[model samples]
Target: MANTKSAEKRNRQAQKRRARNTTVRTTVKTALKKARETIATKDAAKTPDALKDAIRTLNKAASKGVIHPRNASRRIARLTKAAQASKAATK
Candidate 1:
């Protein structure tokens, strides 16, 4: 428990930020998972759209500081590489 007034307020702020971060994190995970699934299925039409959606979510998370910019970049790069490889394999 917080011992001071400021501490109590800080705790409350932390809780709110935690909840917001969790929601953003969950959204990123869902987008990434869907993108991976789309890639695995090799649905040419769906793959690009899914990849774009995933990238967009990652960027948003990074911009919001929920995830590091470099982390988001790494994830985006890896996913894009996998998507490209999948496309090549199909061709």
Candidate 2:
């Protein structure tokens, strides 16, 4: 319960931000999952595109401030490393 008017407004703003952030988070997670799955399945033809999409989504989220830039970069690095390992194994 917000006792002050400003507090109430802040709460409302938080709710809106939370909803928007959730959507972005979900998109990032889904993209990461798809990319990992494509890599795991050894679909070299599809993995690169999937990795590109996942990286793009992560960058978008970071730019929007939904996620930290460093956090997104770390994830992108890990995903890229895994993708490379998978590609090498397949080769």
Candidate 3:
């Protein structure tokens, strides 16, 4: 319960931010899942595009402050490494 007006306003703002962050997080998760699935399925042609999308989403989230920059960077790095390893194995 926000007793003060300022506190009430802050609560409202927090709710809005929470909703926005949840949506962005969901998008990031979905993108990452798709990229991993493509890689695991050995769809070499689709893997790069999927990974690119995931990285893009992660960057967007980080830029918007929904995720930490380093967290996004780590995820991007891991996905890129996995894609490269898969490609090498296929060759």
Question: Which candidate wins on lDDT?
Answer: 1
User: Could you tell me how far off, in angstroms, the CA of residue 54 lies in candidate 1 after the best superposition?
Assistant: 0.3
Worst 10 residues of 1 by lDDT: 40-49
TM-score of each: 0.99, 0.95, 0.98
Off by over 4 Å in 2: none
For model 3, how does the per-residue alpha-carbon lDDT over 1-91 read when each residue is reduced to its tens digit?
9999999999999999999999999999999999999988889889989999999999999999999999999999999999989888899
Local accuracy of candidate 2 as per-residue lDDT tens digits, 65-90 = 99999999999999999999998997
Give the true-structure RMSD of model 1.
0.4
lDDT by residue (24-79, candidate 1, tens digit) is 99999999999999999999999999999999999999999999999999999999
By lDDT, is 1 or 3 better?
A: 1
Give per-candidate clash totals.
Answer: 0, 0, 0
Candidate 3: count the clashes: 0
Error of 2 at 66 (Å): 1.1
Off by over 4 Å in 1: none
Clashing pairs in 1: none
